[model samples]
Target: MSNIVLKRWKRTEGVVNESYTHSDGHHDQSTQLSEVTLTGHLGREAQSPIEMTKSAGEAASNGGDDSHLPNTLTEDNRNEGEAGGGVSPCCNWSWMVVLGATLLMCCILSAFRCMGMAEVVEVTVAWGEVDPTFVLLRCRQLLTNIISSCFGIIFSPFLLQLHTSSTTITIIYSVLQFMWNSSGLFVGPLVEEFNWRKVAMVSSFLSSCSFILSAFATSPWQLLLSFSILGGFCYGLMTSLSYLIIPHYFTRWRGVANACVVAGIGIGQMIGPILVEFLQKEYGYVGGTLLMGAVLFHACIGASLLRPIQNQTITNTSVQLVEPESRTSGVVTAEKKWTTVAIRIFLCVCRNIVTNFSVLKSRRAVIIAIGGLLTFNSWLNFIALIPFAVQAAGHPLQAASTCVIVSAVCNLVTCLAVSMLSDWSKFSMKGACMTSTAVIAASTFAFSVVTDIWWQKIIMGMWGCGVGSYMGIYGLTIAYYMGVHSLDATLGVTQLLIGLGFITIGPIIGVIRDASDSYTFSIWVLAGLAACSFILWIFMPNTTQHSHTTPLSPIT
Candidate 1:
């Protein structure tokens, strides 16, 4: 004999709490907004809007079961129960995970922001002095370390000789950006093969080595090997890892947790310029690069703190392997059995790859991807070229650094503000994304036209706002269009596409500078590219109304 007690409760602040008491001496409680609770031994709580719909569908298919509640658990719910068991217990330690991830990201952003674009003007001048064969033009682009055009500025008389140098330098920067963005294509699979902690630690070590190697680079090609190829790949791995791990530990606080992790970039941006500037002043570029290498090594510590959690997919596979086979079945050969297992694993991987690609089937996701590709270089180009542009307009490097600092502050403030508002149903993340893109476009154009130091600073501040807003909402925007289940795959696929775009578009920007003898036109072209994304995003369909918070479910 069994009994079940169901109670309908009042809604409180848009959330409804339902409690179920079972004769098995267990209580099931769920907290959601405007959703009916299903009956089971231990009723599992649905975490997101998608899960809510799924729960409702499952309940309806079983005839609502209000009068005669089912005694047995469904296979799907049982599996969920097992998986949720591992994650639910780790929420207490989630904040610690955030702290560790924050440290890792802070190091990456500091090194990349400082070494990539912020210090490119000074570093380019220093590098050109060491290798006088290449013409030193005004440092044009520094995003991903675009440094050769800066050489032309120092040796304008040798502009004719800059074609090779500019192209080669652009290639180096392009490869770095390419690897950084495109690595996402396979990073998802790599994470699944080996947990996030191992991937992050190994990558962080490689990144440190890359930076140390950069300190001893004799020519552009050496920088290419150390900084562009190796460093970029490692950075990409950690970047994807940091974003992917947050959902594993967070459910209700997903938005805030993500914001905290991403805020590391803003914090790094603010610190990188000042730190690198001091290091550059005290020690030359070589010494600075070496010390920065040390600073980046700490990421290994942060990566180590990511405690491993149970993988439900792996658990399911283990269960199948141990299931007893019919004794009447003929014995299988060792070689044949191994081959069969390998084939099964390969097929499973292929299926996962296909599913990852399916996110593109959504028209809105495609638009977002295209928009990302078109404007991929906006932030990089704007930040990278500004210092060189400032110096071109007869301002000091200090003034340029000041502008970068101002932008960084604004970026941090705006990012935090947007993150705080993430749970607000009234706040439209898509609109914020579009508005930020437009602001970046306008600021890029204005900064290119106005050479006045004060005006440039003001323009930089505005650009910082746009940068902050975009960074704050980047992940949320992707999940918004593709759904939470597809977040990791979408990031991997979208970044892979944008990485390819850098390969083609990066060189063209360099050539434009070489041909026209100025970065103004390149800036204009970037602005136009940003505008293109803004226009495309305008057509994106509205998503179902819900708070844009990441659910606790593992991204499959």
Candidate 2:
């Protein structure tokens, strides 16, 4: 009985061990099946999304895959969240659009600048019957310099042909100069509120109409009404717009970009004389004036190219939210409360003006403005004095004009080269400006002593180099010192000071020429001013030496 019981126990124990082994095998198989199912589902879901994202990215990139785009979009999307949908804050196309707008602006500005200084002499010579008095000639020189420097160019063949008195023309031109300078104050707010393209289009239309209408003017006042008032106002708008647009497009290459755009002045100066000379020769002044008006119509095409940037659009939207409610109110509400709305608008404008003027409190801005005042004063004197000096030295009007063209060509080359140097080398904007001022001073002193025509031409070329360097770096220096945020206000204030110099100094130089019977005194005075500018530069601050990669912040 004991043997039988022991066998039963052994049998039961073996059976239990076999059952346990079977259960463990089934558990291992189930676990493997579950792992396979999960991997299959994950592959199905993730594969499509990855492939879709890759294809969409490729399509957006056009041809090549840009590694930078992914990171940029990621960062932008993170910042902006779902509302932006991974859109970049600034696109590749933005810089291209800015470049195209800059080219257009160059064309318009070239036409404007060329028409003022170079074409005036051609028009005066072409209309032979008009005998302008000394005062009239002096006034014309003064007004032309003032108007052109302030970014307005006016030419009415009718004024010279109709035998208008120099006094009347002078008065009209002065009023026009004032109008052009004052128009700038309104441009900053307008550009910030509306699309720049729209502003440019309106300006182009007014400019074109002004030029076309001046061709048919029968009296001096009519000419002034068309050319001086209408044209000057529109041209001022265009000039201010050009300066404002540049900073938005570039950062590291700002100096080179500005140089290229400003070089349009040289191009216009080179082309204007030849074109006007040909037109006057082939067609009379009336036909020439009419054709020039047609040429100006092309500015509208340029204006159409100015597209808004993404960052600027964002800024505009934020500003609109804070703007006076009257501007966005219903027509009936605005009409019922017209006086209140008007008061709000006036207060808004005044507030904006004060805000813009706040940039002047910066020590860097003050230094630049003072330096620019002296430099521009000397520049105006050079423009007015060079032609007279050449004439007094027994050269013809053509020779003087040729000298102007030469100076412009030299200016174009020098600006491009110097800007390139500034970008590539360790040279600071302030250092370049100081060196340029010194060169100008030396050149001006040379002009005071030199009597030979050939030597004068050489001196003029050196002077052009100095002027080009100054103009090329002026905006960049402002960006360097006062920061990019303050560029618009700094430019506006600096231009106003320069305009004052053009208006005051040109007439004073004219009086000096009449009294002294020589440009020796005038040239010496300009040299002294240029030297003073250099001295001012030496005392100003230099913030670019250390931390070259860090951007300068604007003064509060």
lDDT of 1: 0.61
In terms of lDDT, the poorest run of 10 residues in model 2 is 1-10
lDDT of 2 by residue, 400-424 (tens): 7677656766766787788656554
Runs in model 1 lying further than 4 Å from the true structure: 1-89, 116-168, 212-223, 270-294, 308-355, 391-397, 513-520, 545-556
Record all residue pairs in model 2 with backbone atoms less than 3 Å apart, i.e. clashing: none
TM-score of 2: 0.70
Q: What TM-score, over all chains together, does every model reach?
A: 0.67, 0.70
Which 10-residue window of candidate 1 scores lowest in summed lDDT? 145-154
Which residue ranges in model 2 land beyond 4 Å of their true spot? 1-91, 113-156, 276-291, 309-347, 395-399, 544-556
Candidate whose TM-score is highest: 2
Local accuracy by lDDT, each model: 0.61, 0.56
